[model samples]
Target: MASFHLEEDEIEKGEETMGSEPEVDEDPSSSSATWGPPHQHGRRRVNNYSGGAVGLNINEAPHVNKDSTPFCVFMLYFARIIRLLVEETNRYYHQYLDELQDGPSPRPDMTDSEMFLFLGIIIQMGHDIRDRLKDYWSTAEQFAMPFYSNTMKRDRFLHILRFLHFADNNTETDRNADSYDRLWKIQTIFNTLNDAYEKYYNPSKHLAIDEIIVKFKGRVVFRQYIPKKHKRFGIKIFKICDATGYTYDMKVYLGKDRTRADQDVTATHATVRGLCRCIEGVGHKLYMDYFFSSPDLFEELMTKDITCCGTVRPNRKGLPDDFRRRQFRLKKGDIRVRVRWNFTALVWKDKRDVYILTNMHCPPAEGSFCDEHGNAIKPAIVADYNKHMGYVNKADRMANSYSISRRTWKWTNKLFFHFLDMTILNSFILLSSCDAKLSHREFHLALVRNMLEHAARGPPRPQRSRGRPPAVSSAISRLEEASRHHWPTSSTSRLRCRVLFV
Candidate 1:
């Protein structure tokens, strides 16, 4: 194994010594951190944002206002959102009336306070899931949850949900037009939240682009089926997140992108580019996996003043012929490197072969790093990837743990609830800056409780029916009111009730 490693390095050294390598097509840039040879353009050589840089310099250190509450922080992102929802929801309700001259309009038009009460219930529902939506309204002692029945009538709550709408029924744009949107049903909500996501907070220098799946099994045209993902079947969203696990931007993947067919870039390249637009032309370090990384993509991004590093597939185009070979084996901690115009393509051996490509760190390929308690570890690039690459995944994991998602066959419901969770999660993240010790669950409970409290104080709550209340069980009836219990006077009775004196 050692001989093989030595022979591989020697062969590469001999080529350089003999000057047998082909010269690059472009002149080297005058930049100080220039690697290998000159490139086509004077692109980024290091990751740093010049205060003089004029683009998206949102190198953010986010903080919540010291005087703010969770509701205030949430409203900061969703105030306009809730208002838009109320307007559209009421519009849709009235539209239904005009269409059917509908029988008694499903429980009066939704109001601002009522809509909030509805949202409060939805948020609370995500905290604890039951068998069915109706279960929340159950009046049985074992299944009773007063928050649901007390805030609003079961029928009224379901009425608002049934007519819940975002886009107007009459305002849908033409499908035949080139600007058609596949997700028009929730497009407004998607864009509104997405904008708020970026507008409120800017990420630090380290950003990662990766795919996130919202678990869905409904029959939708754009639903993705990735067997390897925990959500094996769902909608796929490509998000560029900060090192802090905040989603800075996202692109919902619909089938084949017709928009990219006219462009020279691959779908993955375009996805990464679209997600990175806010951070482009700024010397922010991007990280992704091999599926999104390639020599062309890396260099293209470099030209835009962004430097990225990721694990590369040996078979990817522009990788040297030797890297594409999977036949050979190497001892642990062995490495083979090929440098091309600020990009370093590396093959390091550990439990198995690992390939990496980057225009960032150019670590010595002779030996592995021993940064962990004197034990050998992977190289610098691997260490950095491990540190920053899981931010998106962490965000997903956190959201899923207390997701407000409910069972639904409607694609509209799935998309709406999923993004709703995203909004809550992002709001919680912002609030954390103010109270660093707050947990997501605690923040969520506090936020929902605050909303419910407001709803409780708002106009009179829905009253129970005017008839006799539902019958109580014998056990509950006996324990509540003090009553005289006359036992049958029988000597044959073996069981007796006796009060113990304390």
Candidate 2:
């Protein structure tokens, strides 16, 4: 259909000549038009369309809902997706026995489970449930209801506690230690969510791997230097996002150091290794910045059949002059590469020339691949340019304007700090996948602030000291008594009998 509308110039400029004279080549019985333009060089022919419905469409054009309203299609579609996520999460929680060890008979009201559901729903809806709850319950009198009665919403607080890994046994009132498990859990949840989103994505050959810095608080133990809160930090994430930012696969990494600042070679390598593991066996070309320039890592990845594409760092070590030249000159296992180039230079490597190295062998000429040393070039080719995709650092002229102190973050609750960043990223990915109209970076910037604002809407209720433990019900007492004197009966049956006897 497209070709019929716009053929190549070869077809458009063909040299089909016209005769010098006009003559009727039809029988007298044939219908014909005797029309001619004045002073034409030669006779021309025009075919008249005799098919039906040549002038058909009249009303449908303007009537088709071109209304300037936000389409509810995305809202409905995203709602359905979120609903599925909630149901699946609920099933997973029960299936894995997240509450199994908490007690023998599960509480009719599962506080932890409710919190999980609440958080899941919040994330899925692209809003913070806590903030929404607070907005809905603004007064002390309004909190008298059973759901809102708890001074701190202990269950909800517990959920956040688990999410942040805040331990209950810290000696100092000032001690605010966040747990490792909470951070890991958030990663796990998003990974699972990404997998689920992938099953519905169209299979394209290209995948993009890039990094985006989300502002963070606290000194990351792994990071060498602390970056300003809004300053760039490497967030090594591998995603299979379409041109419109619909992500098929999303893998987020915190970088070599929490700060992802420079001077951490080992951390960078580890980040590459983790990102590479996600890319392995996906049968797509992956892109990276010069920071990913490492020959050993590339070769290791190539051995596993994953091709890489990115600018290679110049100098500092062993790279052959030409990849093609080296292909024949060097042995299979002897190859090693190390990147050493100033990124600020027009061409960072080999006397101010951009360098690219790929197991792909061929890449777009505009993005020619070279070895550490100036080498023979090959035309770049990927199975599909769309599938082997990427977007590098945003042009500096248009970066975000807001700034926050990088140092002040260290004193905050670490898990919430991390959660806040992850939540922004997760929301961006969610909005991108659901709304086919936005780009990855566009979605990241557009909705992230709103999501963070929602997160920062603050508490729905006043903070309080830890409260008294709930009284043990008669059923629990009977269960405890049964534990002391177990009969030759099921624990449930023994407890029931003890309750009646008591």
Candidate 3:
């Protein structure tokens, strides 16, 4: 684990824009005037990757704490974030009670134990799902779940969820029709969790940055529509996760208004920069897709002592115009390389052209062999990118496996669930990487069990359900509380006093 925020020396250098990086000769591959000593066919053949990859050592180096439990790891991230949840929820719940109720308060104010139990119930829902929540409380043979009923009343669960709030609504200025804050409601929670994510654990050097959809179809100004993705339309979250599926950092896409990168920087590039700020100058290796790969970025990262590799779009700036040559193409297992400064651009031919940019890998040893089906060799950079680029995807898959998320009309609510799921995923990763090797489902079960059981002994049971007449209330309450003699239900067998005076 490491500090969530970067200190003085680790802060990201000035944001890099193509215009600002000192210009070099025409990209080596852009020209054919290569009668040089070391350069090759309109390019150069060289490799200088000194930074060795470092991953978390579950039992030793990286996993500083060898003896860790699932609940302890869970608290590392949830302790602070839950406080925010408790405070705002209570504040908003009270405000809601005062505004909506017709007479005196109908329900007691929300308490900490009640809040935790509420969360435990929500977490339980993901592990065990029913068509309707009420079914968990049903007395019918198939529908009855004593576990759910014993945990909390279904109506009380629904009531707390109905008023669950992360931010106060009583005093709000900016979130309106004109100049609205898209993430105003859940902003505090998002930031608090993001901080915990960063500080909870230091990810391995091979980190990946990618976007995952929250699968929302609700009305929103900044909703994304990625046709290729399964959940193609929803809020997009750009996160950097390690090989273990630990989401180290994340930033929600808030459309144009929240775009705060350099003027010339593309939104995608800016996102990568923001997510990478924590690991800057740490000699980490970043793996990303074509959406974020570019020569300028590779070089910029190199300057910070970090190295990276990823697939790149041929049309990206700083690439040779004919980087993806049409007239001349290499056969299967053959590749062409171009070097500019410390960054290398490679094009390998398989079923189709694969363009890759990197400063972390050398070119593949040249050879002609069988097709991909035959498991022919590929450029080292290509293989490395393919291997390490799935960290974020892995994180997404695990989060969705036993998700606490639910369909909601409000984008904030949907995002809140996404955060909840990610937090649990991170905690699972943190614990599993150390001592607990529990499955994603099992970890959640244990987490929910501990959280509920810890706070499960709720306030003492009530003696009366409703008030009696004003004059007789006190006397009737005292008489009802008198337990010297018991009123028993009729039964076939009568109990004999077993206690003996000693």
For candidate 2, report its TM-score. Answer: 0.39
Q: Rank the candidates by lDDT, best first.
A: 1, 3, 2
Instruction: State the lDDT of candidate 1 residue by residue for 1-502, as single tens digits.
Output: 1211111111121110000112245532433323332223223333457323221223432335544566767776677878788889889877776565214423455667787888888988887789888989998887898878888789888888888888886778887776778888888888888888887775777788877777889898889776544567888788888766678899888777655554666778777777877777657888887768888788778777788888777887677667776654666667666666566777777656788887777544554544345434666666777787777877787777778787777777777887777777887777664445677888888888778766667676444344433234543455454453553455345343333321
Candidates 1 and 3, the one with greater lDDT: 1
RMSD of each: 15.5, 20.5, 12.4
Q: For candidate 3, write residues 301-398 as lDDT tens digits.
A: 76676677777778777775567444336776566666555456766676566777776654444446454465445555665676788888788889
For all candidates, what are the clash counts?
1, 13, 0
For every model shown, what is its TM-score relative to the native structure? 0.78, 0.39, 0.77
Which stretches of model 2 miss by more than 4 angstroms? 1-203, 223-270, 316-318, 321-351, 361-502
Cα deviation at 105, candidate 2, in Å, is 25
User: For model 1, where is the 10-residue window of minimal lDDT?
Assistant: 12-21
Local accuracy of candidate 2 as per-residue lDDT tens digits, 407-445: 234322332333333333333333333334654344434
Quantify all predictions' global Cα lDDT against the true fold.
Answer: 0.69, 0.36, 0.68
Itemize residue pairs with steric clashes in candidate 1.
28-38
